[model samples]
Target: MVRGKTEMKRIENTTSRQVTFSKRRGGLLKKAFELSVLCDAEVALIIFSSKGKLYEFSNSSINKTIERYQRSVNEMGIGQKTTSQDNLQHLKEEANYMSEKIELLEASKRRLLGDSLESYTIDELQEVENQLEQSLSKIRATKTQLFKERIRQLKEEEKILAIENAKLREKWDEMQSTQKEIVEVETELFIGLPQPRTTR
Candidate 1:
């Protein structure tokens, strides 16, 4: 009698799972070999067991098959030709990626240079406009604050200079009075009048 179909679940018994893994891995390698021999096709198989053991098989030298694959890729002119459907799809994907990158670069350039956003799409232009406005506002605020600070400094300097001027004027007045007293005393000495008893 035929057995029921196996359920799609993990094998519970460790020994049974190991046995199954060994059998299936051998069968898979055997089929790969047979296909390579019967159809003259290159085959390479690599398997890693649950226990992390590595296994590998190749119809010919694995390196040779890899070199052949590389040669085929080069012969196809992988970058130059996009004629096939798969190649065309790949090219389209690349084009989309490049377009996005270009947009990002342009946006960054515009931001750095402080350019207006009139030429781009509405959404992109709006974004740029917002950023520019923000930058301008910040610059204006900083400029205003700097001007106020400069004015305050100038006022303080003026006040200081005014105080210094007042002090210098008072010193000039004192110097003039001392000079006048000295001239009067010299005049008395020259005229040979009875010298007034000078105060000690």
Candidate 2:
């Protein structure tokens, strides 16, 4: 009698999980080796254990195989890939589109700079003029914003300086009053002194 298929789930027991991992890893490596030998094909396999231990198999250098795979995937797009000839044609079309875009941009730049306008239709010239006007408006708005910010900063600084100046003036006035009081006391003491009696 055929045995039922094992229901795959996470092995809850730690010991069982390690044992399963070891068995499966060996089985997988064996299959990979067998496939490479039987088919005479390049093969690379990499597996990482739960503890991050690396298990790998390669018929040839794994790096070379990885590079070859990457080149194949990129040069011919994945999933029922087109031929190299098709890829070349697609690239040629893309290049042509890019060249056209570059040419258009150069023409627009020339028109914007007031260098070449003879070939442009009226509509094209109008479009270029609109772009220039929008750019100028944005620049003017930015300049105004910067000036306002500067004015705000300067006002803030002026107010701070004004408050500091007021504090210094109050200190100076207090010092002056103290000096005047000291001088007045000294003057009173000098004037209130008694004269010594003269002998004949």
Tens-digit per-residue lDDT, 1-200, candidate 1: 99999888999999999998999899999999999999998898889999899998998889977886786688687664435986787689979999999999997987658676456687876777787799899999999999999999999999999999999999999999999998778443255567679788
Runs of candidate 1 with Cα error greater than 4 angstroms are 1-106, 111-119, 186-200
lDDT, residue 146, candidate 2: 100
- Candidate 1 minimal-lDDT segment of 10 residues: 186-195
lDDT of 1: 0.86
The candidate maximizing TM-score is: 2
**lDDT of candidate 2 over 1-200, digit per residue (tens):** 99898679988999999998999999999999999999998999999999999999999999989997897788667566667887898699979999999999997778889996888899988888899999999999999999999999999999999999999999999999999998778443466668999999
Which residue pairs collide in model 1, if any?
none
